[model samples]
Target chain A: MSMSPYSFRLAAQSLHREKWINLLSVLTIASGLLVISVALLVAYNVNAATGKLPEKFALTVYLNDNLGREKIDALIGALKKKQSVAQVRFIPKDEAMKELKTMLKNANYVFEGLDENPLPDSLEIRLKREAVSPEEVKKLTGDIGRMQGVAEIDYGEKFLAALHSVKSGVRTVGLSIITIIVAGIIFVCYSTVKILFYRRTEEIETFKLLGATRAFIRAPFIIEGGVIGMAGGLISLMSVYVLYYVVLTRMSSVVPLLSNILFPLDLFLLLPLSGLLLGVAGAVIAVGRLRY
Target chain B: MIQFSNVTKDYENQTALRDISFVIEKGEMAFITGPSGSGKTTLLKLIYSAEKPDRGNISVAGWDLDQLKASSIPYLRRNIGVVFQDFRLLGNRNVFDNVAMALRIRGMGEREIRTKVFETLKSVNLRHKSDSYPKGLSGGEQQRVVIARAMVADPTVLLADEPTGNLDPDTAESVMRTFKDINARGTTMLIATHNRELYRNTGRKVIRLEGGTLVGVGPG
Candidate 1:
């Protein structure tokens, strides 16, 4: 028949009479969203924490003690010309020795065997915030490798590899969590709809005999499912925000490390979107699983 | 008007209707009287396109059943009123909205729907019970609401499959009278019933069926 207010009215009445069905469905959807949102938050934080690491350390390039001070001076000048290099500091043998002595002042016996300071003369290269590209960093090191006094060029490949390892590890965990939570949401929604059908079997048969179309029979349940999902998503966002606040307060110092990396608390915006997706996805799959 | 030409229906293993053919003309009231399993209910179902015939062509009000499209089914159902044996009243709705459903499907406005639903309920003697839900209403009242719903749209044909099966004799007679009055007003009626006495007393057209085959047709 024509789309009319009557269908909506009937749907409202049906939902009212079967309040438990809708309530259970909504709770199921909300739970699914909570799992999904929390998983996303954890993944975001992990990535954010890993990205903050490289900014703290300067790359130390050891000078060839043979070609010594003059070439080390030229190497520092060449590094300053690169747009990627933010600043450079040359640590001479004397300065390196002095810093080492101060670092071991508490443990005098640790430095007792040293005739002279064995520390190398080196250039500490600080990268611009925008200049931290692994590929570009490697190329810059190769250029510095040819410098006369440069005995060895070092940007800590081990450190870069370790940082990358954390990034991939966090991503895998995030993806796995997302996949499992989505599947769980669908399973929960499917059962909720099934319960709804179970609760209203008599009413459904009546509609069928009255010549109600399949769409007519289906629309109200679908609408109910959608509403449930949306509410669930909205609720999950609030809970997630509360959790985020508690977490940030507990580990507030880590906040500065999250600068341009993860979705700032603004990433909280993505939580609702994820909620909607989970809600809608769960309802469709749940609805499709049922048969009359 | 309705025509069935060599119509048959089968489930997975059992046949529900045989190669049955029949025609009921416009403005006629006919009873498909038969024992249980004689395909009486299945016959009415086919008229409403609730279930399609496996083989053969059936047409209702000039619409071909064989080639009916999905969109056209609702259009077909809208023009033919159906009163189920079990009443089929939506238990969640009040009597007013229940009877108003048929008219509401025609996209009638709220004001007009209220007026028309009240008028239809008055005709069914159910106006006083308008606010009561189906579960609160008596069996006869529920059937009456269903009848009111069926007649509210003033459809081309009315199909009732044992509309009185669930009611007592007195209530059944009253409901039949309502059906007769509606039929008199030029709405074709096809009622399937096992109770031969109901039709005999009402002096309506009666057709007999046995094992999915029409046995005899009696004069109205």
Candidate 2:
């Protein structure tokens, strides 16, 4: 059905006539959207933080102090042959001791009185980015610890597991919240349009007698729902931006790390578009179910 | 043209119209006059497909009412106009928009709608009240606005139920003149009223019903 300008005019007139009711609907939808947006923001930041951790991830393989140079070289070769291994750097006992001494330069007297270097020779192993999951790291460490010259493997097992856990948890909870909020927004539009339809029962009956089609009678309501949804989306978007700005510019001084939160400005533009689609869907359902 | 062959309609506990038959030829203006509860309104509703007959067939403008699908009812209605006893004007809208509703339903543009609505209102002698709301209009003026709305789209047939029920003698005569003018323009008309004065000596066909049966058919 073609949308006539008269439908738009009727919708505008209805919106003006029921301004208070429309405002209430918009505010309810906006509050729901704002909650969902904030939940999404938290999920995004947590995912980003967890995603970057893998780039600097490393597995330190401590070696036996008496291992020969050839054995160390062989171990390095074996590790490099593994598909998961990206790089391997061998540090001899003397170099390790020298690094420790440099790290303790502020208290040089403590090391100057030591009789011998007790540091172990180790191989710093970096893995492919895709293989940096907690399970993969655990399996790789297990295999290395079983190798001939390997003494122990230090991959911070607890920390890596906690990071992955946090990421997954945020995603699951965020999705659930978003789903509930979206349903709420749709319900708001549906109820509002239904009330408006009932309020105009006389007009609808008059239109029917005037030879108006179902589409013609329903067009104004659909337009009203879409306008309400889009307006709600716009209001929520503005609220989110204001909150982001306040956190970044004002509250960051108290909690400095809040400044590092990344805002996906481009992606957030979908809020109003989503709201419009949902609003139209709600109106369609409300009108479709009613007896004319 | 409208034809009813052996038509019968029944409510839950009462028969409204039963085994009734009549025909109003194309471009003919006729009247159905009966007392209250004599099924005059039900007969007008049947022609417009608002109420279906329990038996027999009805043909209006060549459309078989018995076979008309629900989806096609609106298209059928688009070619017919009904003026109600209650006026049925939108209280919130002014006189112009109320008349413009019929044309707007057909997706006419504003420029054309404005011209047609003004002309129709002028025909009803209410063009001066175009900006007035229905609450501000007298019963006669409101009735004229309803007539303007029904005539705005230029349908093939017009039906009126108690068209001048609430008006005084002068207003009722003026409204009758308006219906005659519209009928003069070659639109078929069927008016249902209990008052015999409307069709007493108009020299038009009159179908009379009493107690759910066709008691008589003659000329006014």
Give per-candidate clash totals: 1, 0
**Can you tell me the DockQ of model 2?**
0.80
User: In model 1 chain A, which range of ten residues has the least summed lDDT?
Assistant: A258-267
| Tens-place lDDT digits, model 2, residues A88-162 | 999888898888888988988888667888789999999898998888988888899899999988887888899
Model 1 stretches astray by more than 4 angstroms:
A1-32, A64-122, A128-143, A146-149, A156-159, A244-264, B10-16, B69-72, B103-109, B166-173, B194-205
Show pairs that collide, candidate 1.
A64-A149
Specify the highest-TM-score model's number. 2
Query: With candidate 1 superimposed using the best TM-score fit, by how many Å does residue B104's alpha carbon deviate from the native?
Result: 5.1
Q: Which ten residues in a row have the lowest lDDT in candidate 2 chain A?
A: A262-271
Q: How big is the positional error of residue A135 in model 1, measured in Å on the Cα after superposition?
A: 6.6
Best by DockQ: 2
In candidate 2, which residue ranges exceed 4 Å CA deviation? A64-78, A81-83, A106-118, A143-149
RMSD of each: 4.7, 2.2
What's model 2's lDDT at A121? Answer: 95
Error of 2 at A181 (Å): 1.1
Q: What digit string (tens of lDDT, one per residue) describes model 1 on residues A28-112?
A: 6677677777777767777667667767647788886666566667778888998888889988888987887789898889878
